[model samples]
Target: MEKIARQGLLYDFYGALLTEHQRHVYEDVVFYDLSLSEIAEEQGISRQGVHDLIKRCNKILESYEEKLHLVEKFEQTKKLAREIQSLTKAFSENRDMGLIHRIEEISGEIVELEAH
Candidate 1:
């Protein structure tokens, strides 16, 4: 993924663990698309401080992901869901037994993942 998209995904998964100030600053940069200078002006901090905060927040969030793997599991589940949807669509068009079997197997995997 691109830097911003990866940041956004990580934030979506792990941002609530951040302190209120860190969450606010992170939201401004990732969600609101504010520059460091704008964020610094709004927060009464230096531009370099804002930059350092974002850098640190990225590391913090990534470390959580490295330890927990929630983001990775989520991506895997989402990919499986999309694949199942496509397979179902193909089954509807072709009435293929192979597609149906694959969909059933993927459904079992999805169920097993949810159990964790």
Candidate 2:
């Protein structure tokens, strides 16, 4: 995955674990696309401080992902869901028996993932 997109996914899955100030700074940096200097100006802190906070927040978010794997599971499930959608669309268009079997297989995989 791209760096920015990976950061967003990590944040989405683990952001709630961050302290309030960390969360604020992180949201500005990642979600709002604010530069360090810009965030520092808004928060009345030094640019280096903002930069350090962002780095720390990124570390914390990544640590959570390493332990939990929520983002990984979500991406896998999303891919499977999209595949099922595509297969279903094809089946609808041409009534292909093969597509139906593939759709069922993928749906079973989804169910197994949910069990975990």
* Worst ten in a row by lDDT for model 1: 107-116
Off by over 4 Å in 1: none
Which candidate has the top score in TM-score?
Answer: 1
Candidate 2 lDDT over 44-97, as tens digits, reads 999999989988988988889889888999999999999998988888899989
Model 2 stretches astray by more than 4 angstroms: none
Residue-level lDDT for 2 in candidate 1: 96
Q: Which residue pairs come into collision in candidate 2?
A: none
